[model samples]
Target chain A: MPTSRMLRRATPWLMLAPSLLVLVPFFVLPIAIMFRNSLARDNPATGMLMPEITVANYARILGDWFYAQIFLNSLAASFGVALLTLLIGYPFAYYLARWAGRRWLPVLMWVVYMPILVSVITRVFGWIVITADSGILNGLLLGAGILREPVRILFDISGMTIGMVHRYLPLMILPLANSIAKIDPRVLAASTSLGASGRDTFLRVVLPLSLPGVVAGFQLVTAVVLSDYVLPTLMGSTRFRILAPAVFDEAIGSVRWALAASLAMVMLAIVAVTMVALNLAMRRLAPWARGL
Target chain B: MAVGEAGLDLEIAGISKRFGSVRALQDCSLTVRRGEHMALLGPSGCGKSTLLNIIAGLDDPDAGELRIRGAPVADVPPNRRNIGVVFQSYALFPHLTLRENVAYGLKVRREPPRVAEERATEMIALLKLDGLEHRYPNELSGGQQQRAAIARALAIRPVIVLLDEALSALDKNLREEMQIELSLLLRRLGVTTILVTHDQREAFTIGDRIALMHAGRIVQVGTTEEVYGHPASSFVLDFLGSASALPGRVEPGSPPIASTAFGLGFELTAAHRAGLAGPVRLYLRAEDVTLSREPTAVHRASPARVELSTFLGALKRQVIELGGHQVLVDAAAGHHGPRFAQGDAVYLSFRPESCFVLPEGE
Candidate 1:
């Protein structure tokens, strides 16, 4: 083959080399090391990694109902947060994209980005203050005589969901708004002029067109919620135990590195499986987008 | 042969619309008889589209009343108004196939599935989109997408059809072809229609009656020939076609005589000089002005030099400088006379009846 043709073919890979350089050392290598550590046994007395390779951690996790429950709980929490955020984010995104023009867009965007800018730990603490039994929410209700007593909200699955949605709502709204804003205004006018009501147009045209963004937002928020540590730690109680918090408790609190590594590996597997499932579903949902 | 013999079809009375400080439409009143094709012709931002949008219920007029078949439609929503529109972009749904897109309106209106399917099939066949019914919009070419859009618009059996520069997006050759096809289709359907276009040729091609709009007001509304041959104002004349204005004055008589700046005189009919007095501007179409190697006795020939000659296939357009005034004239390329070149002195001739004079300030 000609040198020019070979160089031309190699150009794309050369362009991708910089990204790979950053990803390999910082991301890929760390994950590989973590996976290796997960398969190795730890010295009980020395608090050091042993050379002996074993599948004891995996067996323990699979044989036990508690670990299985934790994985299931994590999936449930993430899925719930994704669904709830979509329901709330869709109308807001529509307003930003279709109604609000240059006038209020910047201000509205700042409002959406404000929560994400704050640290996740700070946001979870804020949720705790708001949802706690003796918090302002209960206080307000009690003062108004709407509730007989303080209702349970903090340190539960509901509290975790609220925190997750709050931290990741911007993720959902931005993509959805971007997708919707790109749609030609003529399409909307045509729909109206074709004897379709506003509701019908939105459902049949806007919703289907924005589904790619929906899938993108869902995947991002779900992945974040699945691997979340600070949110589950502060906003959730022992009654609502999840995978991320269990991994943290084993690693730092109990000084059990092997168990922590194994748990992290389990989380990695679950996230990978979920991502693959979501991709398949997205392909089916938005065939026109063609892997967008 | 009275129009609207069944009843008055669509009537818009004193419709006025404003965008911020810009007045888009100002007391624009128009009446469309059943099966009449009216074209709102204007330049961009001349309120032609604003009027169409108001009539289609896509927009609300600040001050006016809209009545369809003698019933007020102010409170009726766009969907409930039963008006169909073909947009400039065609705006076909990307995800839906041609058949589904055509059937969308009927489905939304809750028509029975079988009935909707039959109507969609008939419309698809009518628009000659037979085998392409299963293809998505992205899979179709520009012309096919346009036909699908038209099919979708007409499927609902709307009370009125509004075409917003519908053929403007297509290429020139295809646009002309579609124009002829659309004109014949509209005539066959005999549905009351209003088309908005900035292209004068397009307006002349499709419109039975033409309404020339300027600066948020309807300047003139008449039959195509009436607007073209006897424009109500200088603005209408200029918008409708290329014309050179000759500053002239009306001389009173049994049949009045008009003296123009070209050192020529024209005999005008009494009806043509009814409300005119003193100074007037005579508008002459490019084709009406003829060139001669020798002076003719019918109309006084003005000596001019050709500044520019543009060969446009069959018709050659020339810019001739007559003394201090410049006038445009169109001559056939295959004419028997000697071909005039740049800087060539020539005599210009045109009949008085070809002139459309507008009074000062009109």
Candidate 2:
């Protein structure tokens, strides 16, 4: 029991010590001071910080459904962005892993992941030009007569997803591509040589091996979408309060520290539950993967 | 399956392949007969494996047509070729169970689940792999995985089964065991199998007909007995140079005799041309000729010197320097006639039937 306590006591704080070296003073101290500052209500009776802590700041944010609706909308919008990123990324990743011949594999693969090297803001700006009301996409669509008017695609959830996907696409693609690459080409060849047509090889060998990468990518892109503070806010309505934006609104924008901490806690809980659920599902399918 | 669909008479017509500037094969052609267990034997980079790949449709021939049962494969893709190939690495699906891997081809052929499972089970049992059906490839040892690969190929009941140095991955003892087992299994199945190996012993051991490949071309292809006993070229004599050669010229005699160093002559009275007399080479297998203390009924005792004698199992195969580069002769141990000491002179003679006269080269 003493040894167990010794290990337990020594492990986490020891692990946290390096992080806390930067975090405790720089991250934690600023946040703590913010929490202390938020509690101090500006009173006409005092010239300094108020002595009494109050729940009045918390009451203001939660008092109306308009504020509550913003949180829900941000959640929906971020979830959409994440799922959409996964949809467009999966097939491209599969191509990178399979159809790219071995000779051109490395160079072609770099094109798939080349976006990651640039800044997120630059990517957002790139999406702005791409999906602008009369931009290249709309210009092409209008020239084809798919639309009568140059459709306004900017400053919307669709536009935001386009931006987010452009940024987050790499996260999803890398995992899915790794899975597709790990698939034994012989497995498909063996299947086809036995008389299964082209479609059958995909259904039997190509899809199954890429399952782990799909799940891992979904979790990654989803968590990333939820926690992203910049792209959604920069592109969409200010009322849409995704977890990351809500944290930013309280901790930096409005400087209400308690609300930010509570939102952060909720985000962590959601991620933890989602990961645990996925891990359990993976355990059931581990036998199917042949230890891959 | 029917016996009619079992064998494949493959005519590989002028197959050539080149990658970049390096030619893997150059205008190689071979005719493999129906139901023949042929082996392509060569060293690495000799294109033996490349030839096997071309036959199996794994690699395309740049300049030739591949014909199975006399039908050219100009329009058919590899998957439609219906050829079963056993790779050097075996290439068993690591993800599938031993049973699943074998059953894969059957399933792809759309044999009903019950029939596929039944046939797979039968094949597994036939190959004596019944107990470990559920095991994945990684769980099984190399030999077990190899058997599984063979079983998988056989499950398809293909017209041709190709093995690309399939036994080279196994240890020596395991390879020998599989060689006999695999050849016997293929014969029973009647699956015209072509195996590639660098090892001549394995080629001779498993092949009903062996083709010795040198530099992308099949130098010789024949039965084990023919390839060994009557080597076509000096390339073969050098390849099968396990014994010694006594090069001599045929002069006049009642029975033809070729003379070696210092008037050493080997007399032959077998069914050879009576008037054939010239400079010729005689190939003596180390095991075929023997030594004796005196002239026995079957053998003739002549003079020799035991320049170097090595004890190898039941007999001592001595290298007698009949002048240069020594000819090998098998002598029984504990023999009389002074046991010819090193550099000591004695008479060396062997059977007339055992002395083979080659056409100068082999």
Largest TM-score belongs to which candidate? 1
The sequence of per-residue lDDT tens digits that candidate 1 reaches over residues B27-103 is 98888898999999999999998898888888889998888888888999888888889988898887788999999
TM-score of 1: 0.92
lDDT score, candidate 1, position A213: 83
Interface RMSD of 2: 2.3
Q: lDDT tens digits, residues A146-169, model 2?
A: 999988677777677778888888
Task: Compose the digit string of candidate 2's lDDT tens values, residues B141-179.
Answer: 999988998888888888788887888899988999998
- Model 1 deviation from the true structure expressed as Cα RMSD, one decimal place: 3.1
Error of 1 at A3 (Å): 11
Q: Which ten residues in a row have the lowest lDDT in candidate 2 chain A?
A: A42-51
Interface CA RMSD, all predictions: 1.9, 2.3
Per-model CA lDDT versus the true structure: 0.86, 0.74
